[model samples]
Target: MTKGNLAIVLHAHLPYVRSEEPGSLEEDWFFQALVECYLPLLETLEEASTAKDQTPKITIGLSPTLLSLLEDQVLKNRFEEWVSIRLELLNKLETNCTAAALDLKGHLKRQLKSWKSCKGDLIGRFKKLQTLEIIDILTCAATHGYLPLLRENPEAVRAQLKTAVREHQRLFTNAPLGIWLPECAYYEGLDDLMSESGLRYAVLDGHGLLNADPRPRYGLYAPICTRRGVAFFGRDSESTLPVWSARDGYPGNPNYREFHRDLGWDLSIENLKKIGIKEKRPLGIKLFKISSQNTSLEDKQEYDPQAAKESVEKDAESYLKDRKKQLIKLEKSMKIEPLLIAPFDAELFGHWWFEGPKFLSHLFIKAKREGVKLITLKDALQLTPQIQLCNPSPSSWGQGGFHNYWLDKSNAWIVHEWSKAGREMVSICSGGLIEESNIKIIKQAGRELLLSQSSDWSFILKAETTTELARERINLHLKRFWILINAIKDNKNITEKIIDEIEKEDCIFPLISPIDWKKKI
Candidate 1:
């Protein structure tokens, strides 16, 4: 069996967005990502799955939070409607086009057809890709937990892993073999919990390998295993930068779509005042494109979809060339074909880089034809089983590459409350923790507490890109934790008030048990 030896890891995640309103404005953020990123990615994988020359084997991690969103019936229905709205816009543009805008009309038609075929229904498409063996989808923390911070107690970390793995099994109908540590935040002993939870491998920041105590012999090009026998793939900065670094990456391409110049906020008020008879809201239906750098709306040109597709192909080729060089350098030093691990936030594909999905498809085709290997992360880890027994120090892929991103001056307040709450829960539970033989209520609250303490939400809040939303999520979980913890402390019976509130919040991963978690301690 020949292994092509290169692996790609795409981590897809979003904070829980179960809004009360039917058409929450914030929901657009996810709907757009689905249309632009997730569905297109599924399409690319589906096509590649049956390609004669090469069948691609990619590794994808969908956080449990993302899975909940995908499975959401309400969100699913709204997404169908959202896609329909775009289709209608395309129709309006087509009929309204003049002879002078024939090219623009044609471009809109092609985009409309693609959107029609997808219909924003990615769950089915992804399942098809999985069945075709084009990709291996893994699961992460229930809420993309920042686990290292929860390490003070073994049970807290274990509960997060147990709940996440079980949720993955339920969704995929297969136990997840790999895990994606949130933001690749990992510490030395994290593998113990992962291994216990039946996870085979997990990823870490590039520095995790470089900073390994005994030092990783294969460097960033290959995976290292812990004493517990769990594999760890270190992030490769060389390949990651060209796509992640805004100052230098492909998203900044002059020819590609501009994210900041969205018609939603850029269009004239008069043009968007009323979209339809039933719709009291303006949908930003107008279409426009970037004519030149620093060009105002008056100077903007019509959007060209075909030209953008061509640019996707060109950029894809450039990326492969860079990867070839990277692989060559690694093989020279290690004398072994080391795998180049390029893990990215999947949302970056279509949401941030509108042409990213096309670029990825083109990349797989170009690499396979050129004899560049694209393998799954699981297969790569299994290649070299002999690993040094060592633990990685606490670290994250955040700005400071440490907990400071969530605990520092900018976000100190979040931690003060979080730590206080977490410690209080532990102290309360430890005394009579699981004393009752059938204490189902205490167990339920324990799961809620663990989910709420997840560090991802806090870090995202500190970043302030979507601070309020992040705050609400944290508060939601914290509120549930407080209610459940209060019931346990007061020896009061758990009421529907507890379950209803949690269910209403519509949080995923509601299956974890606190008693099972306590055993890990």
Candidate 2:
């Protein structure tokens, strides 16, 4: 038994990115995450658990949209093709390569090998991990909808909860025990809906607990239960900062992979164009190290895989020692074994910070040796079942630590359209138009509505990188939804062409039912 416990959570998400268009940028995001992050994390777990009789515990929140992509037969095959392209590019680079490019070539080969090894059965591997008690899976709100902004319509929020539970059950064959409230966005009574959906616990930012009614005695070190019986685990930033911060985190060390210095931007356009890669953008083959924080892209040093491994080992040991000392300090005066919850975006590891998955694998093994247990949120609660009852404040882990990143002037106009479509969805579904007679159209409308409400579109609008595409996505989904809704209302003949296109384009939640959108009032 360890004196302290750490729960490291990875929230893996991307909005519905499948498209009818070939080489779609949105779909590229999905493929990149799978290649760079998801596969590596899975491989780490697979290798770490090779020893019989010991299961490594990791909590991951897989969003419905992300799971939808992973299960898409078309996208699954395309991801293999995506890997092949990078391997071909590296093969071409091998002839005139520097030592740095040679090392990156080796990395690409291993990624390709792993992709083949999985044989399009990644989800089965995840299920195996859970069955082995090595990974505890959590679901996110359907469509990755930011719940606080959708508070005006409780029915809409309830629909998100219902769909998550339903979709998770379809894939995992069991209801999930926790949810990553999209962006950790929480409101006054969201937990009641979660409890009703049969979830046992959820996580929030530290401030969400600090401001709870009567305050918490353990601050972010303990779970607090709402009157609704749902437990809220606050994120301990102290556990996160050493690895996640961009400016000072261990990932920024001089030997780690340089994220921005890709050969896609450095090579000639004709070379990339031969491989179907577009001009002036990354093709997921980076070859440089972040030699210094202020170094220019062209001057960056070569990435040394051996040196980076050393850095990961040293950093992981330092982190485990720090936590052990922290627990010793807290135990001196505190009554219970302190729990530290460190939650981070899963993409940060192999995608953004190339050494992230390796760091985590090391952290887990080291913690076990140092007498600090790596427990899932579920296991931690079982160890310490006592909870403090309080009403958590309305909070979000967004910009400004509230809802400004979602609700500010840059994207405020979206709420009106989302609310209007949401109210109409509940009304139309409740009005018996959801019958088996017109169920296909109703389900498509529900799908379009969910896609339009994705928080990524609004976040993109604010980020200004793809504002045009973001606006078009939101408006197009809303437009398809209204066309379906009004056509059903008018009893008009809908063209087969339109229906076919929508069925292909908005293909997510394969088992979603019209009843999932029912008004809960």
Top candidate by lDDT: 2
What is the alpha-carbon lDDT of model 1 when measured against the actual structure? 0.69
Which 10 consecutive residues of model 2 have the lowest summed lDDT?
93-102
Cα lDDT tens digits, model 1, 1-521, are 12336677899887666565654655665676666677667767877767776557788998887887877767766665665655555455543564323543453344445656866446666666777767778888877667776666666677678888888888777889898888788876788788889998888888888888778777776677777878788888888898887557777666666556554564455644443323233242334444456676556665566677777788888888878776776666774577888889998887777678778888778886555788888667667656655566567788878777767665567555656666665665565655663255555566567556666567767777767766776776677777777776776776666576665655566565554454324
Q: What's the TM-score of each model vs. the native?
A: 0.86, 0.96
lDDT string, candidate 2, 1-521, tens digits: 55778898999998887875556677778877887899889988988888553336879999999899888888877776777777777777644367666766676678778877878777888999999888889999999999998878787887788888899999999999899998888888898888888988988988999998879998889899988899999988888998889788898899999999887788898886777766567777887899999999999987888889999999989888888888788777668889989999999989999999889888766766777778898788899858888878778888777888988687999999999988888888777775566788888888898888899999998888889888999999999999999888888879878887898888877676677667755
Candidate lDDT values, in order: 0.69, 0.85
lDDT of 1 at 73: 68
Give residue 514's error in model 1 in angstroms.
2.1
Model 1 ranges off by over 4 Å: 1-4, 89-125, 267-301, 424-444, 454-456, 493-498, 519-521
Clashing pairs in 1: 188-392
Model 2, residue 437: what's the lDDT?
A: 61
Residue 275, model 1: Cα distance from true site in angstroms: 6.3
Best by TM-score: 2
